[model samples]
Target chain A: MRIVEAGKLALESIWANRLRSFLTLLGVIIGIAAIVATAAVIHGLNRYVAEKLSNLGKGVFVVQRFGIITNRQEFLDAARRNKRLLPADARAIAERVPGAEIVGWEVHATADLERGEHVIRDTDIGGVTPAILEIEPYEVAEGRLLLQHEEDHAAAVAFLGHEVAQRLFPNVDPIGKELRIGGARLTVVGTAAQKGSFLGFSQDNYVKIPFSLHQKLYGTLGSVNISVKAREPARLEETIDEVRAVVRARHHLRPGAPDDFGILTAEGINDLWRNLTQTIFRVALFVVGISLVVGGIVIMNIMLVAVVERTREIGVRKAVGASQRDIVQQFLVEAVLLSCLGGAIGIAIAYAAATLLAANTPLPAEFPPWAPPVAFAVCTAIGVFFGIHPARRAAHLDPIEALRSE
Target chain B: MHAAPAPDEVIRTRGLVRSFAMGSATVHALRGVDLVIRRGEYVAIMGPSGSGKSTLMNLIGCLDTPTAGEYWLEGQPIASLGEAELARIRNREIGFVFQTFNLLPRASALRNVELPLVYAQMPPAERRRRATEALQKVGLGDRLDHRPNELSGGQRQRVSIARALVTNPALLLADEPTGNLDSKTSHEIMLLFEALHREGHTIVVVTHERDIAEHAERVVTIRDGAIASDERQPRPVRP
Candidate 1:
């Protein structure tokens, strides 16, 4: 019965002082909504990229030096930690590896050039053999791809990166245009299709020429990496072992020596992304969790003030036989109800804000399966933790003194 | 329990003293007082402010323990009990009415009346029934749904009386119950107190008005925390 009265009074107080209640809830609302919206966007972007990256094949793997991460230094460090491999290693793996299909040789260099009156300068030029196209996502926009005959001839033909074509030939076709790089004249047979951005730069902003051209122009000492495709992606490990055997024999390495290369898979990239984002989420959780602490403090202070304001009420209840424990429990329950109510409001606000953002803005958001319950649990904890001191003070008050108080 | 004490001394206190420290001075609110109240008796404690009338009412109602005294309440030594035990005695025994008509502002009459029963841990159904009957007894049968703010001064006082009578406790403690009401309403409330006394409910009322004191068969006066007078007119009291 005391609990009932306490609950009634608590609800009435919250209703009467609505502005203050709303203000107190503001902290929670902003914190939860921000986190939800931010999380949703991150999750959406990851899904979008994952779909694009993994669409072509179910389990295709890429083995490279330093892995597929963006930081060039980390790649170099990892490369140095392992031994080096020449293009002959790829040739050996292509001939001896059984489970994987169509291994490729790739080399990359950068340069400036001119042809006739057209000049394309300071470009990202990639050198690759014809087999590289089989393992990579590439399509010709005009003419045709550099064939085996062209590779053997070391033909002076170039594929214009989308950005380079747009810059050099904005209103005209790029095919049949000639450009020069490393003082060598080359004809543009195709142009890369539009690819907006990858890791913050246009993916189409690159040129792919034959590997032999890169060896001659960039010099023999230029760094390079070998890429392999599995004949059966599901049997990737078997092919990896076969490649290692072939490479060890070709390079004449001892059994115990570490190979100079790295094997990177799509799932490894996924793991790296998840680990990296999870740390960011952890930090976001801490920041938002502090808002809950502030919310708890607001609740505690209000409850204490409520206890003081209702001193006469407490006295009357006592005169009628309310026990100390009864009073304590009543107030504690009221505090719980108050904070839980605020928490519920916070969750609703988060959802509404998330929906609003998802509808009108590029910011991506989705409600987590556990977020609402976690929010409620946080509110409950805040209530209980902050309620104790005020409840105890009310319960332990002197009945006689309290009754006589105004 | 002294074999129930002849029904004339439902309450007895000896050497009761209550003092408060106000800055540098010690204010004695009840100074070594001795008193006895009979069952089914109507007693009025009257005095000016700071004359210990309220103090005696507090001690008599078992709201407070005397600094030094022996208090026998329903054959129990309330003065020697701890706060929890004292609370039990207060819950099952005393009904307090204040000058301010201290009804909870947000509670309806029925809820206010059910408060004591709640402390007694009475089942909700029985509590509801008893509270309804108590309100009907106070002539508030139609006002049970009214909160304190919704009721008039007189009606509010009646609701408080109903709250006091709900548990059928050993005694009703009324401290200036009509202090906030007009003269006619005060007279009517006093008549109700007299009727309750006649109906075998022990009552102790505190007032500063001599006319209010006349409604009780016994009148006790206190001055400076000490008993100044005690008188009872036996068999000749006007109903």
Candidate 2:
């Protein structure tokens, strides 16, 4: 028989047993939905991380006492082995590293801020050099950034993050407003432009002050983080090596010994992100694979039952001159049609779920354009893989025996 | 043993034998039966249960192959043909009507009639037209859209007959065509067969009922896997 006719016959049979067909499709539906939804979440996260990392400046790199510690053991080891990065290290890198176009350093602590009766608790406060603005550029909404002489003379002036400024000075202009940080009053010199939240955490919720004042208030025991900008983006690796050499020489490390510090670049962060997401993607793939196999087995089992139930019908078809190939084609077509229908339903459900997740939750989801076609192809492969045996069994039945069956 | 069938012959069988292995023992369904039926002949094969008449019918319909024999349909050697070739022969040269009107329960009468043509790979429009013509010939032209469950036993049988005739085969083979019908419906079906035979179609009816066998021009009776009598009646019984 022609394939079209066989398809029509399959559709008729499936339609005749609607509830059974739907039950049979459930496993495949769930399998494909899991795959599509997981892929959408991963795709969205990758884009989000890439965009966030790009905000770290084109060729900027950071040197710190502990960089990207993944586990408690690693954090403990780094804490014991690494030395606190001092302001001297930043000055040495600025003087010695020829490829470093700009070098800046910063120190941070959590502090409570108060203006008369209004108070904001546990807000991040940073002490940064004047040159840090050139390395990591922040847009100013009002007033101006600190001058180079402000750091030299330890001026009691602070730059407020957009959220901090809005909260502390709700009705008045934040510029030149005085705010108390741990009993040390500092006037706000400028307010940074609003930077939106990332992964539901507010980006504009910190205060920046001159490095000399922070040293006096928070003390010099804590380690400082050093930021370096390369003269040319293409030569960033060479500039990083130069900075590494300056820091290692200053620490007096031997040739074979590991450096007592960590250097982080944009590419390093991207690689770490990709490594994490790839692991997640692989686990999702494994789970989806199992579900699909289970789904396929269910389909095969049902098709075998259908073959037995319709033995007499098969005999009638064979008696009407349907060849073994024709019988096989008919059953195989039915199996594929059933699986693809499941895949289509799965794609629709995944799309709806992805849209809902993106709309209502902090977790982002982006439905990939190629998901539907690829899902259908996988489902077709599964159908054929599971369908062949039952179709062959139907084809090989003795016509006389089949006809004799009730 | 390799002789060709005559141009006017519809079926020829020689020393046809069929056996089955029922557990450890073998049962011989047909043993050394020879038969011939020419074109335009209305023949009846009659036998009691376990008399091998059904075996002969199955072999003649190309649904089963004999253990040892030479059988031909429309001058083609079919006993040695493979399953696919036998299926093709069944499609092009033989039409079958079962004891139970075996129409697809879900399909309309028209689609049931179009089944053979579908396997024949005929295009849709042509298949539809020819199937309609066949149903009209069976006097079911107005009942084309009715499913088998919606039709009476007689109408269902007529639909089966239309399906059988749609391919315009060399032989119309019916196995107990009226076994499930009332006497009136049986009489009508037998009359329809008579009309078809009058139009020069080769036909075979397998039944144990003497009255049903009497409708044919000739009757062959089987006893214990062999033909006991083969007689040509001067005049076949009418309605």
Candidate 3:
């Protein structure tokens, strides 16, 4: 018999038992849905991280005491072995490394800002030299950035983030206004541009102060992170090597000894992010694999039952001259149709869910274009893998005996 | 056993033997039966229960292979043919009318009649046309869309006959074709069979009823796994 006829026959029978067919399809639906949803979320996150990291500026790298530590033990080891990065290290790199265009250091702490009757709690505060603005360009939306004379004189000036500016000085202009930071009074020199939140955390809730006054207010015991920009984008690696040598020489390390500081570039950060997402993808795939296997087994069990239930039908078909191959093809087509239907439904559900998530929540989700075709292919393979045995059983049945059955 | 069947012969069997195992002991269902059926002949093979008439019918219908014999249908030897080949031969050479009127219950009479042509790999339009013509020949032209359950017993049998004739095979093999019908319906089905035989189709009807066998031109009786009588008589006309 032709495949089309077989398909029609299979469809008729499946339609005759709608509830049972739906139950049989549930496992495949869930498996495909989970995998597709995971792929969409992971794909979206990957793109988001790439975009965020690109904002770190080209040819710029960071040197810090502890960078990208993953586990508790690694953190402990780094804390014990690494020396604190000081402002003098940044000066040394700026003076000694010809390839280093700008070397800057900054330190961070959490403090409350009070302006008149209003207070913003637990706001991030960063202290940096005037040159840090050249390395990490913070956009000035109002007033002007702090001048070189401000840092040289240890000036009591502050740069407020967009959120802090909006909340602390809502009724009046923020520039030249006085705000108290941890018992010290400072004038707001500028307000930074509005940078949106990342993963639901506000990025624009911070204040910047000159390095010298930050030392007087918060003390110099805390380690600072150094940022360096290469004079030329193409010479970034050479500039990093030169700075590493200068810093290591100042610390008096042996020629073959490892540097205690961590240097991170945008590429390194991207690689780390990729590794994390890949691990997540692998775990999701494992879970999806189990679901698919269970789904396939359910399909196989139901197909076996269908074979037994249709034994007399098989006999009638054979008596009318249906070949063994025809019978096998009929049943196999039915199984594939069932699974492919499940896959299609699953993909639709996953797409809707991803769209909903992207629209309503901070979690990133992008439904990949390749998911549907690949999902259908997987479903077809699963159907064939699980459907062959039952189809063959139906084909090999003795027609006389089958017809004899009630 | 090695002889080739004549061109006019629809079926020829030589020393056909079939045996089955009942527990540890083997029971011979057909023991060295020889038979020949010609084109356009109407014959009945009748016997009491367990006398092996059904087994002989199964063998003749190509539903079972003989254990130790040679059989030919339409000049082709088929006793040793494989399952696939047997299926093809059955599709192309023989039509079956069952006592139960084995029409697929969900299908209309037209679809059921189209089944044999479907396996024959005929295209859809031609299959539909031929199936319709066969149904009209069986006097069911207006009942083309009726399902088996909606039809009376004789009408269901007529649908089966339409399905059987749609293939236009070399032989029509019926296993107790009127067993489930009342006397009046059985007479109608037997009359249709007579008309089909007159239209030059070879037919073999297997039954234990002497009244049903009397309608045929020839009757073969089975007693103990072998033919007991092969006799020809005048065709009976219904009053």
Backbone clashes in candidate 2 total: 0
lDDT of 1 by residue, A1-406 (tens): 5567668767877887888777766665666666665566567557756765674354455556445546888667766665555677677777777776777777777787565566666778788888776677676676666678778888888877778777777687879977778778788888866766654556777778888877778876644566677777778777777776776676577889766566666666777777877788888888988887787788788888888988988988888877788788888887787787877776777778767866776554566667777777777777889988899999988877787788
Question: Native contacts retained per candidate?
Answer: 0.80, 0.76, 0.76
CAPRI accuracy category, model 1: medium
Of 2 and 3, which scores higher on lDDT?
A: 2
For the record, the alpha-carbon RMSD of candidate 1 to the native fold, in angstroms, is 5.1
In model 3, which regions exceed 4 Å deviation? A95-99, A134-137, A231-239
Question: Per-residue lDDT tens digits of candidate 3, residues A37-134?
Answer: 99999999889888888888889999999888899998898899899999999988989999988888899988999988899999888888877887
Question: Please, what is the TM-score per model?
Answer: 0.78, 0.95, 0.94
Every candidate's DockQ is 0.55, 0.79, 0.78
Which lDDT tens digits does candidate 2 get at residues B131-178? Answer: 999999999999999999999999999999999999999999999999
Error of 3 at B78 (Å): 1.3
Q: B143-235, model 1: which lDDT tens digit per residue?
A: 989999998898899999998898888989999999999988887888788778879999999999988888888889988888888988554
- What is the C-alpha local distance difference test score of candidate 3? 0.91
**Residue A230 CA error for candidate 1 (Å)?**
5.6
Clashes of each: 8, 0, 0
TM-score of chain B of 3: 0.98
